[model samples]
Target: MTIFTANPHLLSTLAPFICFIVTVICLLTSIKIMRRYRHKQVFIILICGLGTAAIPQLLNAYAASSLQAVPESLYIISTIAGTISFIIINFVFMKMYAIGIRIRIAPILLLSLGAAIAIAASFLLAPYEIGGTKALGFPVLDFYMFILIITMLVVTRHIEMPAAYFISLCVMFSYQIALMLHQYVFEHSQPWLGALVMALPVLYYFLLFYLLLEWIMERLLTTYQSAILDGLTGLYVRRHFQKKLAEMIARKPAAVIFCDIDNFKSLNDTKGHHAADQALQQVASILRDEVAPHGIAGRYGGEELLGAIEIDKVKPQTIAERIRARVEQETIVTVSVGFCTTKESAELASLVKLADEAMYYSKSTGKNKVTSYRSIPAAYKNKA
Candidate 1:
């Protein structure tokens, strides 16, 4: 056993420097998770957990070395904080991604009580000797290891995890278990590298940071998409659709179809608003089916839908007829559609005006009809 008895310069600087780096990384990641997801209490708990383990690592670094070990008191206290924080993180992850997992207080109470009892045992069982030298906190370390490995297994097994996460976690926990077991065997039997092995759990801590970052990115993307998309109809809102339409107009020759439900107000009055909403959704579904592969469909207003497409690729009349046939066939309602394709008119407002005029012409003559702006009479054009 080659152990440096004098001031071990390399060991001293390398160990603490590594722990410091881990602390900073954990703190920075937690802060980002905190600021972006401030509304979530899990982030607060996560930050606290990360800091709890990190702050104690500086003390732990000193505890490591060739000749001396960290005080048992400092060691056990740090372990307790870290163990509890890990449990909280486990709980929150279960709550977040584990569908149908029980969140009742029983599991938490059981785990906390178990950890507390084990930690206290470390305190009560102290002042012992390992290999004829004064030692402490080893049993507590061992027990805590048991609790963590088993708990992580139970957590990931009972709940569903994404395949990548599950595999990554499995690899991480495997390394933790392997390192701890090596420490347990060699702590009493031989001169060990206390500083390096003891600090390896921080490597696992970094993996936790990775998981949190991935979750936050997924959450932000979902939120942004929800903002632009309508929850009820799964269509783009007017503002986003308008923005996209302008972009499309700039790219190629574009056309638009504007449609409104026929006798929508009467249907709402007679069949109740529920049926009216179903009718609108049905019309949206129909429009959505045809307006794709170079097109967009959106809710222009209540009971109104607008479909936009590239005139060079897709004929405007094709989408309008598909929607008309589908709505009349599938639902108890019908639509009045007006399609406008103008190479000369480039502005969105002008296109909408021409479409809306033709749509109103259908409503005036009779319901359940499709009209093109080119088909409207000169007198009606003057009125329009």
Candidate 2:
């Protein structure tokens, strides 16, 4: 037999532990969706958590069962891996799964001190004897402390999450804590303890399962929003605006207002493209804030914004005036606005034409002015 396989019972001893480790890895693999993703940090931390639990168990088993037969190098590597994993879990918990930590010396010092103590206790301390069986017992204590510290962190965070997330966490935490209690306090080294200990990894797996679904849904929503939103102005793109405008036309006495930046192309030429883009973004912001309460607003191509508001709540002229005034005040740019209100049913194309004609009237008559569709000159209407 080969040196590594000399012990016939190694498979018997390692199979269950290896299976639990596999379960942990499977949790990670299942959640790994390349296109639809969220919280990469959490995925990494979970891998750390798995190693923190699994590596120590595997090494401790080898050390206790075949201390004389196993190479000393294997034992040393286990000690290093386990000690680092233990320290990482504590530090990670304190940071609350965030990339950055607050400026607090106490948490750092506390982590350093705990890591030092755990490393020393695991490597230097004597094995615990129970029922005439010799065992390196430091890992059990270290992991129990891990559960306690993370639980404290959870409480401090007030478990603030969606109802689904909160319930999943609570259920998993309850199962894990109960299993730890059973394994450590009531029956150490029991065959049943080994089976039940698998529960901890499984419970955590379920928590991650729920979290994976949540992450996917959030990603899909974010992607959908991006698809519909204009990149520069944070307004709905033309496609989405067309849909919303059609709906508004069918649903109510809707008004459409079109506003165009005065001499926008000249501004782009004089002030540069960067300044022009900034001006457009600023104008879109004013339109969004002013028009959102009553209706929807979106970019209708460059240097122009469109609002679809139900005229009963507020007139399109009033909404257009607010937007024009705000743009003049908040930005260096001014806009010419033309609006049309309809108390009766009107086709979307016709409404847009009326609003556009009025806006062109303002563009031709005066640079910064508000014009209504009804006020457009007869010649302008005929031309339109």
Candidate 3:
């Protein structure tokens, strides 16, 4: 509070150093994200924009701290660089919103045009002299801010933007309007006003950092889901399902149910791969829905689905019969279903093999019926 109430000149002098630190932090974070994520275009653009934005702040900090007089040409160059960097940062926001279109040449052209305009504006606009202090002003930046707000509003109408990003944009827009009012309408440089102006950028950068982290987390989650789930049936892949089954058997009494589509090869040969794939998906969907409450289901292999359930929760034979009946009634093909309870064999491999043997017996005997390992005769089991 005291700092805000102190001499406006002192606060204004410290603003550059504070802004420089924040920009460098954001630039470093973008670089780290790029290195870890294989150099995404958004991270690269953020790094470039932040790096450019940092230059003017560094120059201003140096000029303010130095005892010797700084050259007017250096000040002009800093002003032009700051204006151009602002344009680049605005373009970054636009790029984020319109991700479907790859904007390669427009940004480069806009940067070049912005540089020319900024250079001309710096010379054409006279310096603002207030309270015996001279400050360089760029009226063009205010106009640019107005255009940016309008463009962003239009872009947001067509594209969905994250809440954090929209909030950051609103903060920047409000700050720009307030800063314009302070500089042009009221024409005052009060200590509180200067401090308010300097503090808003830090908040904006923090929001930007959070938005990037959210995006990275979403990508990681999507990749993880893709790795564990089957692409065609949306069931767990064989390896992950086995791992889950092992854990389940270790905890309590469980049963393994194996299902194989009947006449899958014949269907594939006559009806084509597309039709066969549809049948597999339909059967998998039925297994997934029926078994999800009591256990887990997976794609064991081509046209083969596997499930594991705790015996305490529900009967495995009932679930298997439901799956078989559903496939027979709803899909273009039938399934031979078999199940082995933990009472028979608790070991994961043995349980799966026994269930598969029972399924094979069903396939050989009938084709669309369900078989429990306990129901098989001792002679047949001995032969198996």
Candidate 4:
């Protein structure tokens, strides 16, 4: 204890306080994220791991050189427990990525318990005297540490995550390895050296907690986006069209183009569902290629697509004609387009309905032609 206080190493005395703050912060942050994200259980396991490592480090720090005569056996047992906890936590983290969240609690607890037992038994019962069997001294410690590093790297590579987490993990492991090698070969056992060791994992916990927050945020954004997109065509769905229409009405200068694949049902019946799906996808691709840059093209319904674009000086019919021409040139399948501009109707839904009517007119007059409702007779428009 006197040696630790007198030691010049800044890492020694500072380690416990640093560990305490980091562990508490990580615990609070993880709990907060779990509540906000509602992706619990896995995060709970992670927090437990951080707790296991942090609590023992604190205990070891206070008891290491005190007159209470902390048994070496206690240190060994605590280290074993902490190591087992870490292994279980990492395994749980790994499981989440592979299989997704667990719905059943029993199987999850069963697996976690089994993993913890196996890891603990390996340290407590093994005969080889793996990595040295004391605090960060076991050869198995190195093996497990190496495995954890590799596992973390592998997990990071596959999962979408922030750069901060991987960088922190790299620093944490690098220091651990350095400390282990220093202890094993140099015979340097200064208690202060343990401060840096404890701090490293705490840093890892903080970074991981932040990464989890980011992960949850990203998932929320993705869900929001998917809600508005058509699953089949990867284009805007009808829901998105209504939103775009509202914007167009506010701006008062946009084109609405309605499109329908010619004889799509017949084609589907002749070619079978798979080919029809491929044809639909191909048509969607062409539509996206032609209109997506200038406007938003979305699958409105089966065999129907809608697009809207900002129109400055040019007529909406011109925009619609261009899209129709591109679809004809790009794919064997042709689409009939009907367009109306905001000058004709300010209401978004009315404009889209007008466009749909015009498209139907094109189908009636002839297939694969672009038409507008401006010139068509009211009776013909009514029929359309």
Per-candidate RMSD, Å: 4.8, 8.9, 4.2, 5.7
- Compose the digit string of candidate 1's lDDT tens values, residues 76-145: 6766666665666667666666767645557656776777787677668763344455544346645565
Query: CA shift at 58, candidate 2, in angstroms?
Result: 13
Clashing pairs in 4: 130-139, 131-137, 131-138, 131-139, 131-140, 132-138, 132-139
Per TM-score, what order, best first?
Answer: 3, 1, 4, 2
Write the number of the candidate with greater TM-score, choosing between 1 and 3: 3
* Residue pairs in collision within model 2: none
lDDT ranking, best first: 3, 1, 4, 2
Backbone clash count for every predicted candidate, in the order shown: 0, 0, 0, 7
- Per-residue CA lDDT of model 2 for 1-384, tens digit only, reads 001112234443454355345545544553465223354564466456546555545554454356343454554445455445434443433343333553344653565466556656755665433334332334444554556456644754653344554554455455455555543465344545544444444454445445556655776787999989998999998889889999988888888888999989999999999999999999999988988988888888988889888877777778888888888889989999998876422888778878887898998898678898887778777876
Worst-scoring 10-residue span by lDDT in model 3 = 1-10
TM-score of each: 0.78, 0.60, 0.82, 0.74
TM-score of predicted structure 4: 0.74
Q: Candidate 4 — what's its lDDT?
A: 0.65
- Minimal lDDT window, size 10, model 2: 1-10
Alpha-carbon runs more than 4 Å astray in model 3: 1-22, 36-42, 56-83, 86-99, 115-119, 128-132, 189-196
Please list the residue runs of candidate 4 whose C-alpha ends up more than 4 Å from where it truly belongs after superposition.
Answer: 1-44, 57-74, 99-140, 147-169, 188-199, 313-315, 377-379, 382-384
- Between candidates 1 and 4, the TM-score winner: 1
Error of 3 at 195 (Å): 5.1
- In candidate 2, how many Å is residue 68 off? 25
Model 4: per-residue lDDT, tens digit, 201-233? Answer: 656656655655666676778898799888778
- Whole-model lDDT per candidate: 0.70, 0.64, 0.76, 0.65
